[model samples]
Target: MDFALSQEQQMMQRLMRDICSDYGLEYWREKDEAKEFPHEIWDDLTEAGFTGLTIPEKYGGEGLGMEEIVAVGLALGRHGGGVSGPNMLTLGPVFGGISLTEHGNEDQKERWLPEIVDGAIVSLGLTEPDAGLDTAGIKTTAEKDGDEYVLNGTKIWTTGAHVSDYIVTLARTSPMEEGSRHQGISLFVVPSDADGITTNKIDKLSMRCLGSCEVVFDDVRVSEANLLGDEDSGFYHVLGTLNTERIIWSAIPLSAGELALDLAVDYAKEREAFERPIGKNQGVQFPLAESKMELETAKLMIYKAASLYDSGEDCSMEANAAKFIAARAGSNACDRAIQVHGGMGFADEYHVERLYRDVRLARVAPVSDELVKSFVSTNVLDLPRSY
Candidate 1:
């Protein structure tokens, strides 16, 4: 099996590196300190055509595959952390393109995907106040009218909701099936200003500059044309879309792990302790060595997952395993980086502190650590599924 980047893939990585080179940890740290999103950098990425790298070319996108997509995200994350790359780019593809690419009529694609590629923001509405990882439990419902659906319910932990102009929201369209819990669930596109929508900011533990909103939909109206896929099949389709999401998440953390390792190694060479460079000490040298090993392992797993996804293979187990391993390695890498930097690491002025906080966010959402374990145990080992 060939395991090499094509000329085009290398070129995309070079382009992303050039763009991300200008937005270092200091720029991200300053944005985090202000609790504000980086629209200036956002504009730059938009201008670069990197924002909609996954959206179809017919809709004014580059139509790049997962290999190129991961390459772009990883290069950015290797410098700017998650938000500056995957966290910022993946939402548009996952939510904006989930329906548009798979089910959108020509008009829908014409109406939305081009703008999304051109930097019009889009986001998803799946995780609700009550629905964490149990997407089937989503209480949000869109009742059908003659040509429009009146939507009402609440969604929580919605990232980029405030800035996005459109949302692919999952809602209950039919009453629950007698035996199946996932049935009767549907997805729809809702305009951000659809009359009855309201958002309140949810204070976050980290990625503070990345906005998550608790949104309430009060009788919002949407046309029937906005339905994402066949009514009552959205749950399956949404889950399908997330396989890519997991890869993107997995790939992103690997990049962050690289950044963490880079920070630790560079710091060790320059910082002095006991009249010698910290690089000479085993305490310093060992952790960095182990971190290098772990980061490389995690990266291989991420690529394995991404390649399987690109080949249209069954990648659930690989994706879950990659995300689990990569996130832990990313956490370990940042922690080790911070430890290597000593007091300077804790001080945001030195930058490792920001990586520490951002790296922690890799664990909590998308799929929680416990849930990923459950997925592997049940799906891969052929054990019983856990509730």
Candidate 2:
């Protein structure tokens, strides 16, 4: 039950903090305003080896695990990069690097891992038009055609497709088995520039820098070699990826919330009302204090899940709990910070507005807070399936 970070983990945290300091809040602010990806900051992180924390050393990565990645993400969020900073790692390192190393055979790893370490962006094409979080209900099909598979489908909320060189796509390779919707699903490493693949950016409320998109695949053909994991077993394999994602994702909003609170506290100390600073008022102090405690609690859970995952343990419950609690804690912290700042919180110059928008998206994305509760009710409480 050692809670302290190892020496290497601390160094990685310091490196991420230094990198974010180099970029500064204004860098993220300008990128968010322009709806452009922060290529410079990402390149810096890649050069520093933070981008490949989850990748194996043999593949030109740091050969670390979930615990180290969580630390890096938290540092990114706390040091002023917000969601976009941590998201760069998510696109390639967590999604591409982890997936390939865990499921892909030797040839697949030899081919993709080095490319990911070299800073290739990999977007996830999972959510379809008909299937939101219901991954098993995806309508996209990949029909076997001799030695190739012809893919035809529509994927919505495919984040970073515009900048991604590859998209880890999920498709139905065979008809559903009776009473088992999870069967027949398969994962593929689809090339972003393949013919018949059209990606149109979807304007969103928050985290605009990375961008989410609607991608259409009409008869996009991929070689059999691109298939990830055992055929019809992707549903099972992806479960591990999802758990890893949830665990590490806890840091993004958690970091954003901490940054927002810091801004609010700084403003409260200097902003005087009736000849006294607002920090003296209990009305202002209580909510900020509560947010601090809540965020602290969520941080512990996040690290617990990450450690368990790194140890090859089942962290499904811990991962969901961490994400659920962290999202609520982070979003609530941002809201309170806005209230504490009064009208200035609405202005982007203060940065709380952007933090609020970006952190709030965690409640519904990757997996909704509602679904997280549903998972607890069933898996943790031994209740019947609600959906």
Q: Candidate 1 lDDT, tens digit per residue, 74-162?
A: 88888675534567876676567645787677888888888888787887888987778999888898898899999999999888888
TM-scores for candidates 1 onward, in order = 0.97, 0.99
Worst 10 residues of 2 by lDDT: 81-90
- Please give the CA lDDT of all the candidate structures: 0.82, 0.91
Model 1 clashing-pair count:
0
- Cα lDDT tens digits for candidate 2, 1-387: 788999988998898888888888898999999999888987988899876778899989988888888888999888988777786778888889899999999999999999888889999888988789999999999999999999999999988999899999999998987899999999999999999999999888899999899999999999999999999988898898898889767888899899989998999999999999998999999999999999999999999999899899999999999999999999999999999999999998999999999988889978999999999999999999999
Candidate 1 achieves a global lDDT of 0.82
Residue pairs in candidate 1 whose N, alpha carbon or C atoms collide under 3 angstroms: none
Q: Estimate the lDDT of model 2.
A: 0.91
lDDT for position 19 in model 2? 82
